[model samples]
Target: MKFQDLNTAEERIQLMEKLSETFLSRAGKNDEEGLFPFENIKELKESGYTSLTVPKRYGGKEISLSEFLCLQEKIAEGDGSTALSIGWHMGIIKSLGEKNNWEESVFKDLCEEVKKGALMNNCATEPQTGSPTRGGKPVTSARKEEGFWIINGRKSFTTMAPVLDYFNVSAVIEDSGEIGNFLIPRNSQGLEIDETWDSIAMRGTGSHDLFLKNVRVKEEALVELFQPGKKGAAGWLLHIPACYLGIAQAAQTYAINFAKDYSPNSISGAIIDLPNVQQKIGEMELELMRTRHFLYSVAKKWDEANDETRSMMQPELGAVKLAVTNAALTVVDLAMRVAGARSLSAKNPLQRYYRDVRAGLHNPPMDDMTIQALAKSAIK
Candidate 1:
């Protein structure tokens, strides 16, 4: 379906369903070959999926947070890697536009580029600093030259690196030690993508390392300064949990179908007729429902909340990620159990789901931090 046909949420969903047919088919192959899903991303870009969250004033759809999460979950249901890869672009665009995080002229230019299928993501993690959320100054140093800032550092886990049009890199100013995110265009001098992504899960995401060896950009590229001790409620991160939940849903469906179809001479009927198998299915459904309710409710609440109300929701947001991700892991485990040892096969979708869902545990809003924040919130 053409993007012009997508005038409402339902139309957008229909388009996603159509695209998922191809994503679901290519998912296993991409995982096996450890290849990036370039075609899948192309489909998203051409279908205008990448621009869904760009502000409407920029001639884009500008879907709400809840709608964005819903679409993300839908894409993830087909391929976790594809969903996770693009989620960064969609979420960041919405968040940046809403917050006006960049200079007006630069942001307007970015929005226009997004409307024309441009994609971007934050490249914050470093070999030394790990997740930027852990509060370490970037070893990536930006030195002011005659009229530009020259950056030098290696950022790890630069998701969608193969297709990203922009890389918003975090670095400390060499002169004053002020930390900031520098917007580096993909074609900038001294910028390179090292094919270092070899993770066991989400292998198709192309989250390779980005090496900036004296990459220079105009000073206007330093979009936002980092305020170390302050943080706002980032509802856009709901995309992370939403992806895992989608993988869990896929696992659940696979197990159910396997139970219904797989039968042996030892049994009178399909395995699904067995009480043990039925129990697993029941548990998976319950967990999935709980996960969806927790995620969707929080996303809707974020949509309706003002800045003050949303700021206080940080704990709840962290809790949602903690709860939903853990629950997704459980659901996938149960699905694998229902599928038996065959699920461990290298080609099995369940195996892929198992590995992909586990990545969530390590994603930002780490479980330890979430628990600590919850504890602090409760005590106060």
Candidate 2:
């Protein structure tokens, strides 16, 4: 079936499985040495996976959220970092088309880039400013001048900075006295990539810091989606769950294999034969199943939803993101417990999975803040 024909969940899963086989080969190396997965990205471009969400008007297949999640998990099961890195790009692409903005020309240009397998990443998060959690600290300023606007400030965690063909940066718009997003090309003179992503987890994501000083972009590039705060920026929040779901899937697969092969000296034959180990597997399976279901349900609802419906699903998505990410972390921890000390070995996948999965706690809208928002919504 054609990519667009994959409306059913099963078909999407099958396609993702097929994609999973190829995504991991080069990604493993990249994850180990903190190297950028340029080759893996090239494969994605050639495979026509990069434009999975570009609208049909731009000559691309627009997939449902469930399908997108399935694809993200498959790629991530192969390499969590790469899947996450790409998910950010896909989220931005899909989100731009999620609503009917007056910025068709900009979408047209972005779609054109998608056609060429070019990548665009969200440039949010910053030093000193922290997250947009309490609605504060947007030090990055945009000043309107002549026919263009110049942005000045630092943006950290700018994933895909290495080969990002374009960028959608959020800054304080000088003219409007409001926060807005602008499309900036990667090579736009004053933009610089700082390799400051040395971390315990998701290091391969290439999430570096972007330092912009007087970087000028065309006025038309400024695209404001409903006043940042009130516009309901929850769409981008899905990237977190998409990634963790993949990481959890990875842990599940690895644990099953290790269970089948590992033979404790005391156990009768294999680790899987033991009741306790079997129970652990069962628990992991349940968590994986429930998380997957929640993620898919949220995505499907988003796909079939109207703008208002989608906007209201923020609480649901945030819950899924929080639950799934935390589940992945737990699943990885269980896998380590089942595997014993072997899970910590350099050759084992659990260590990397553990570190990579923990990144969700720090990624976007934050778990604590999200729950509080839900609580406040409930109180009101």
Candidate 3:
């Protein structure tokens, strides 16, 4: 279905389900070859999936937070890597529109490109400082040169690096000593992508190293400035949990089907009839249902909230990431138990799901940090 044809959330979700069929079939091959899902990305762009989050003012769909999360999970079920790789762009685009953090004309122009299938993502994490969420300044620095800013630094784990049309790179301004995000076009001189990603999970994400050796851009490229240690509720980040939940769901589905089909001579019926197997299945379902409830409820709240109400939800937002991710890990573990040793087979997807779901533990809002935040919130 075309983007213009999607007048409602249901239509957009149906389109994602249709695209997921192809992604599901190609997922294992992409992981085996350690190759990027270029075709999957191409299909997303062609089908106008990339434009779904753009603001309606920019001639895009302007989907709500709940709708975005729901569609994102569907995509993840097909391939975790593809879902995650695209989620950054989806979330950032939506956040930028809602926050209006960039120059109006510049952002509007970029939104126009997004309508035409362009993609972008923030490059904040560095090898030295780790995630920008941890509150360390970027080693990447930008210097003012005449009428332009010259950026020089290497950014690691740049998801969607292969297809990104524009990069919002965070760097410390050389003169002012302020951190700012600079928008660099993909074709900028001295900008290169080094194929350095070799993670065991999310292999198809093409999360390579981004190198900038004196990359230059117009001064207007400074999109947003950072206020150190300051943060607010970010509904868009719900995409991370959405992606992992999809992986867990995939693992659960596989285990259920396997249990129903693997009939043994020791038992007259399928393993699903066994109480132990049924127990695991029931546990997986309970965790998944709980995660969906927490995730969708928070997303729906964000959609209905005003700016002030939304800003106060940072604690809840972090909690959702923390709760949903941990729940997803448990769900995947239960799924593996149901499938037995076969789940560990190299060809089996359960092992892949296990590894991928664990990555969420390392994602932003780490468990320790989330616990601390909750503690501080309680004290206040």
lDDT of 3 by residue, 255-358 (tens): 99999999989999899999999999999999999989999999999999999999988888889999889998999899999999999998998888888888
lDDT of 1 by residue, 51-85 (tens): 88888777777899998888888888899999999
Q: What lDDT score goes with residue 356 in model 3?
A: 85
Note the residue pairs that clash in candidate 3.
Answer: none
Cα RMSDs, all models:
1.1, 2.2, 0.9
Candidate 3 colliding pairs, count: 0
lDDT of 2: 0.80
Clashes of 2: 0
Instruction: Give the Cα-based TM-score of candidate 1 against the true structure.
Output: 0.98
- Cα error, candidate 3, residue 271 (Å): 0.7
The window of 10 residues in a row where model 2 has the poorest summed lDDT is: 225-234
lDDT of 2 at 329: 88
| Higher-lDDT candidate of 1 and 2 | 1
